[model samples]
Target: MYLVGKFEHSVNAVQLSALLDITYKTAWRMLNKIRSVLSMESQQIWGEYIEVKHEIFNQQALLSDDRLQKERSVAIIKSVKRDENNCSSSFFAFQLLSRRKQAREVLEHSEQAEILIRLNLGGHSSVDMNPRFQQFQKRNTAGDLVNSGKRTCHPLSVIASNAFSWMKDKFHGIGDKYAQQYMDEYCLRLNASTGAITCAFEHTASLSLQMKH
Candidate 1:
């Protein structure tokens, strides 16, 4: 009952521990296991139109009195509409010491054009393609495709926005290291809504990741 309830909502380890009347360590372990499954399930989802966007969060170190003196900021990458119908989304969080290179690095590596080309070649129609994405689809030049993902990537889907809001409310603040895990959990929930929740559970169970007691 606890696991199922937790799956339905976003609750951090501390809150989950208090809710279940269990030790914090045990709660953390259980949440980690579940998050692992969610991450695995997200990896299995493939799509053509992936919108990569970044969200900025304030670092804990900058919360104190020294807030004005070059406050540190962290950015996380989130991808939405992995499939043609915009049914799935995925998120990734990366740590950066320098903010100057964050946007450039994301654009250089995400390969939005490559994903679109491969999917279009594979015969999947893009669902919510931006104008730039359409241009990439029509053109074959490497220069046109490269560095275009940054501009073509749209904002988050409605479901993704809701999930992020839910996570933010539940956790108060998210850390850089575990942002991916939390994002995966939200993705699983969003994906499960397309069909039956049982199927999502079954899919996670099929993965060979060993779980603890």
Candidate 2:
């Protein structure tokens, strides 16, 4: 629970092992179990006005084939809400995309009928895009396909950049297989409030009991 509360600061298995006087393997397993639980908790359907940005992570690719094998595609989703005072707040979620799926599934199955999608059409030419996503780009030629050059300093972008940097600095770098779990952990920490740690502790304890039974 302590380690999960400090997720925003980045905690690795090595550090947890040293702190708990346990083997690295045990610490790693414990950490991943927590991440897996958080990932399950993050699967809620999002509605209302949401912004989706497709980004390529891990390695830079100069060619299409290299991108398919070496890089990972992720959708950074930001859902905005307003209070009675008209102050805006945002919550974020991430979905790792496979080469065959791309953002087509996300667009097609969205709960909202009119969603505002903002694509960062910068260095993503090498990505193996879904045919439907390509058609979406072609159909929405009225300024929906945003150029990366006109980027603004949005909070969502900052959170995404920080997540990459945190993983690099702490875990050195994560593989594509476990990337979604790490992203889930990051989003959990980002969206957590003051009482969130207590809630996490209760939830973890419940899960532990269920597993034992």
Return the top candidate by lDDT: 2
Q: What stretches of model 1 exceed 4 Å from their correct place?
A: 1-7, 42-44, 47-100, 103-106, 109-157, 196-198, 208-213
Q: Please provide TM-scores, in order, for all candidate models, with all chains considered together.
A: 0.51, 0.63
Clash counts per candidate, in order, are: 1, 0
TM-score, predicted candidate 2 vs. hidden true structure: 0.63
How far is 125's C-alpha from truth in model 1 (Å)? 9.8
Error of 2 at 55 (Å): 1.1
Tens-digit per-residue lDDT, 63-166, candidate 1: 43454333222232333343456555443322222343322224333344443343332344443322121211222244254543444322343343465567
